[model samples]
Target chain A: MSPLQTTWHHIRRSPFQSLIATTAMFLSFFFISTFIIINSGLSTVLKYFETKPEITLFLKDGLDTATVENLQKDLSSYQGIKEITFISKEKALTIYKEQNKNNPLLTEMVTASILPASFEITVSEPEVLEKIYQNYSTKTNVIDEIIYQKDIITSLLNWTNATRQVGFAIILIIASISFLTMITIIGMKITNRKDEIKISRLLGASSFYVKKPFLLEGIIYGLFGSIFGFLFSFLLALIFQKSINSFFQPITFIDLNVNFYLILLFAEIITGTLLGFIASWIGAKRYIKF
Target chain B: MKIVFDQVDKKFGIVYALKDISFEIDQGEFVFLIGNSGAGKSTLLKLILNQLKPTSGKILLGDIDLSNGNKDDVNNTRRKIGVVFQDYQLISDKTIEENIALILDIVNYPKEKIQSRIDKVIKEVNLGTRRFLFPSQLAGGELQRASLARALAIEPEVILADEPTGNLDPENSWNLVKLLKDINKENNTTIIMTTHNNEIVESMGKRVIKINDGEIVKDYNISKKS
Candidate 1:
């Protein structure tokens, strides 16, 4: 018989045994892809946070309009300066008023003239923000202290990196466990077929001839497992997309990229094939002599 | 062509199963091996099939030394030998037709030829009515007959029946023996039947080789007229 035909026959002979191993492998891939999506989402959020202007220098009470213009020009030419935007006190007051409009008490406390003139400073990289602050702090004309949300950014980076590490570790552990489980199941099934295999060999069957059916069964398992895994991951991503959009709507964090889907599909296929091959190989190796 | 064992010795660890056994079966002869349980009848057959390797001496199948035969030679040897056992050994899940076709399938017989071959073998074995039945669905004699039909389907040079009638009733046993004799006469297929049935040995009136404690104690040929 052809290898494919033999494999189909073996699979039909034991449907439940094949299904259990494939389903376990499918879940492993699904969990792994879900972890990948979450990590990708967090990294995108961190990248968005990095792009916002970090330091804002508020000017003192009576600097002239020409002095402010000269300050903006000098800051623009400074090293480590990616961007320099002069936010006039009036424009800053308008933005703040719009933001706090719902809080009537806060709205009454802020006015165009009362707000300080500021130069919004964005550094090339946040790691060198301390040096940028020190350089700007030494300048006499730059009146008020630098305003930067360092603690919030640092904590976000830490949490995201930690999540990435922990998520990957957990995925690895689960994959390993599921792989072993599938192997055990396949091994048991192979053991049950010991009599049939013996009869085949004694009847003049080759090793390749005996193993063809089993390898075919493994391939079938892989195809079905990967399909189920992909469906599961896709459904999960769809469910999570709404929550992600609601949470990070201000930042462009929810990326529904087609490339990511393709990568996830590839991961599922790889997982399915490896799981099936390893399980069948180990099982067959134990029972099939030569 | 004839098969011969030349001073063959088989040992498992320290115990000898068949020691210094020498015998020959001429082409187209129906022979019976008679002994108590564990008298090395099965082991002798196994040596012929290369299922068990003899520790010393040689087994010749028409001058090919099977004692030192490697896997390729062993497999080639099995192609010409059809074996049936006391237990049916038919795959329980498959139909009687599938069981008969299995050996042919393994040997890569043409797909078009398999159906006709199965039909012919089942009809020859008088199992045409139950060709579609599974092993579990058949009685002991019918299962044994199905197994024999499967063995015969390959059209082998040698038919090895190991206690072929062990599980059958007297009537079934007689029918099976008659069937084997008929197949032997029609095809000139060399039949080596191992059995404890002395009545069968005498009734066949052919050749009988008796084994006691792994040694062949008696060899006799009976004329057909008697």
Candidate 2:
């Protein structure tokens, strides 16, 4: 038989042991990869929030058209500014009317003249929004109240960081359990083949030659298990894709990236191979006497 | 071409199994190791095979020192000496032909040569009809014949049979001894076996070496007349 076929024969002979060991490795690495992928996406989303525009400025009543135009030009070249948008008082009044139409009590109080012309201002970054607020809080007739949603920015960062920490901790715990489980399965296989190993040694086979089949078995277990785990995790990501899209609407949730998935695939195969090789090596080494 | 033990001492843990034992068997010699249980008969055989290192003293197969040789050299030496055990040691799951083929497989004989050699040895052992049967399916005599076929398949210069017929009935045992004698006569292969049976020993008409209390008590050449 070919070496690979021989390896499969041994693995096929003991299905239950192989399954349990492979499953442990699969779950450990799968959860770790999934947590990393999702948390990294969340971290990117948090970063995007921190860089988004925060404040808008409303011009004073009865301002000339040129003065409003001049304000846009002035803010465009100003320091600590990311972007500026000029909105006419009529457009502001229209937006105000449309928004408040559902609330009749507020619609009666709102009018075109009452609503001032405005320039929407976004600072260099969310962190600098407060700096911009401090810089222009007293600037004469340049702005009405400076408005930015700092609560959302702060909360996003805090949540992403917390989840990343928990993800890391869980990955570590699962890896340890999988390591122990794979090693145990290897030990059992060695015990079962105790006589065969002794006979091989007596036949003048080297320790390594005798250990080949067991080590190969472990590698195969890891490979098939990881591929299976990767498929399951991908399906899970797909099932949640729509909810993720709706919840983070303006900021699209990225599906698994092609490059990142390739890397994870390589990781799964290597992890499986190493786990099998190491566990079987350790187990076979103990029993395959020279 | 011959095995020689020069004042070998073998100890297992705190007990001395064989003490100051020395003997020589010439090339193509047919001999039997006769001793009671625990008389160091098996220990001497293991020493000659280099399976157990001598506690003190030397073992030589021809001119090569077994104790000082490296693993590769020991394996090369082993390839020249075919060994059979009392238990048959035939892997129960493998068929007779597969069991014989295993030795060539381990030694990495070319595939084409392995099949023909297995077929030749199977026929020589008169096990051609039972070649495809697994060890568990075969009777004790057939299993023993399979083991002999495996040992003979390698075509070694020396054949060491450790109680090859120990577990067999009289008819089967006699048949096995005759096969060994035939192989020795036809191929000039050195044959060494250990047995306690006096009737088989007397009928063989070969050299006999007896041991007692870890020492050689007797060594003699036997003839058919007496």
Candidate 3:
């Protein structure tokens, strides 16, 4: 019989053992893939927020066009400033009217003279946001008020970092457990077939010949585990895509395409297979005597 | 291929499992290794199989020195010899045919010839009808025969039957012995059978090497004596 055929025979003979091994691997890979998806989504949301206008500097009520133009030029010359847009009072009033278009009373009440003109500044990095805010906050002569979502951005960053650290710890713990479970399962199988191994050796079988089936068996378990794990995560993502998108409104947080998922699946499969190979190698080496 | 043991001594810690054992069996020779329990017959077989390295002296299978050979050399030596154990060590999960096929597969036998070869050996052991049966489904005698068929599947230069009939009834034992003799005559395959059964030994009139306390007590040909 071929090594594959032998492995299949062994799995068939011990379905419960195979299932236990596959299940352990499945749980580990499931958590790993879920963590990846969630972390990716969080990163997407953070990126969307980071790229938005970081600081909005509202000007003094009677600032002239030249004064606003000078402010725009000054902001443009600042380091880490990606873009600086001068929103005139008329433009601000137009935005207000558009935002409240459903309510005629709200739109009719807004006028260009009442609306404050502002400079909407986009920074290249989150680190630069606080610096710009500090520099403009003291300029009350030309600036009426400075608005920047520094606290929200800081909190979002902290949450993403925490999720990554905790997710990584969980994956490491579960992966180690999964690896040990595989070794124990394969070791038990070897122990049960101790006599058969001895007989095969006595019959002139090589060590490779005796070990190949076990390694293949481990690979099979890992392959199935990773494939099923990927499928489960994919299905969950599909089911919750709309909710997740709405939760992070306008961000398109979970917009992964089929190609991206295929790549992730491939990576998970490789990891799972490598884990199985190493675990089985250790198990076979530890137990089987030539 | 011939097997030669030149003053081989196997020591496990302070005790000697075999001491200063020397013998040579020519190609195609049929020899009975007669010894009582704990007489080191198993140790001698292990030495020939290269399962245990000799503490001192040498063992040679053909030109390969088993005493100091590497793993590849040991495997190469083992490939030339087929072993049948007293327990009829057939894999319990596999059928008789699969058990035979497994050995053939291990030897890297021609893939196309494997099925035909398995059939020939199963037929030789008179297990053609029971080839599809697992070891658990077979009787003791049939299990031993399946083991024999597996041994034959390798087409080995030497066949080592280590107390193969130990668990069988007298009739089964005689039948297995007769089968071994016929195989020996037909293929001219070197046969080394270890047994404590004096009746089989006396009836066969073959060469006998009697071991006692890890030493060779007697070596003679019964046919010549008669």
How many residue pairs clash per model? 0, 0, 0
DockQ, cand. 1:
0.55
Q: Per-residue CA lDDT of candidate 2, range B155-220, in tens?
A: 878888999888999999999999999989998899999998889999889999999988888999
* Winner by TM-score: 3
Residues B44-118, candidate 3, lDDT per residue (tens digit)?
988899888899998999999987788888887888888888888788888888888888887889999999999
Which portions of model 2 show Cα errors greater than 4 Å? A54-128, A134-154
Fraction of native contacts (fnat) of each candidate: 0.49, 0.14, 0.76
Better candidate by DockQ, 1 or 3: 3
Off by over 4 Å in 1: A1-16, A53-65, A73-128, A135-154, B61-65
- Whichever of 1 and 2 has more DockQ, that candidate is 1
lDDT of 2 by residue, A1-290 (tens): 44566567667778899889889878976886688668767976887776655676656677677877876776666577777777787788787777556568978877777777777777765556676567567765766766665777778778887888888899889877877777778778777767666655565556666678888887877777778777777777778877886677555565667887788878887877787678767766665665
The prediction achieving the highest lDDT against the true structure is 3
Deviation from native of the Cα of residue A132 in model 3, angstroms = 5.9
What TM-score does chain A of model 3 get?
A: 0.83
The iRMS of the candidates, in order, is: 1.3, 1.9, 1.1
